[model samples]
Target: MNQERFKTLQIRLSGLSNWLITLAVIGILISIGLGWLVKGILILIVVIVITPILLILGVQWWLKRNLIQDKCPVCSQEFPAFNTTQFQCPNCGEPLKVEAGHFSRLTPPGTIDVQAVDVSVQQLED
Candidate 1:
């Protein structure tokens, strides 16, 4: 999935996870109020063990999916997002520059256009 969809999924998952924890808390409270001691303990155990695991796994996948992976036009080889800000390519040592993208409200909905701008003449050596 694309980035925006992935972000939306993360948000949704966050909300769902929060809602689940809240429900578990409510269930525990209700069970205790009704004197269902065994039911309350079981619900507490499941919540304490399961909810955090699901949240951690979801966050891990979200982060992995967001890492930038692209082939360099110069070398025709792939590099990880960790090197995006470096001035030169890891393989060919060709000069590179990193720039952040900006959003335009004028653009169409549900799309982002990544355009390269010429900043090669900066005083900083390539």
Candidate 2:
């Protein structure tokens, strides 16, 4: 899941970087080479608007991908899961939950295969 999200974010960032680079080149040409003040200002506005948004999204993707953890929706703190169960936020002591659903990719094999045990007894003239 994280891998898929990371890959998607990476592709988006790559495409945004390419566009930013192209716009930057154009801004440079307009500002310094041609001295087109209005066009340069417009391009500068676009740069200022998009750079921080892209940076924030990139950071979010990196944290989600590399941290290998989940963020608590209650306290907004990050935590790890031991099994398919609920937990609390360590930092804020808030009640939180972590449900990975059925057949998660992170779940280990044979974890859910076991069922109730069976017992048998034989008696003779008891």
What RMSD does each model have against the real structure?
23.1, 20.2
Error of 2 at 20 (Å): 30
TM-score of 2: 0.30
> Tens-digit lDDT track for model 1 on 3-81?
9999988988997998899788767878778547657777899999999999999988876765556665566667665
After superposition on all CA atoms, how large is the RMSD of candidate 2?
20.2
Model 1 C-alpha RMSD to native: 23.1
Q: Kindly report which residue stretches of model 1 are placed more than 4 angstroms away from their true locations once superposed.
A: 1-37, 82-88, 93-126
Best by lDDT: 2
Q: Worst lDDT window (10 residues) for model 2?
A: 100-109
Error of 2 at 23 (Å): 23
Residue 50, candidate 2: C-alpha displacement in angstroms: 0.5
TM-score for all predictions?
A: 0.33, 0.30
Best-matching candidate per TM-score:
1
Model 2 lDDT per residue over 42-108, tens place:
8999999999999999988866654447666544665575445555567776654445521122234
The lDDT of each candidate is 0.65, 0.66
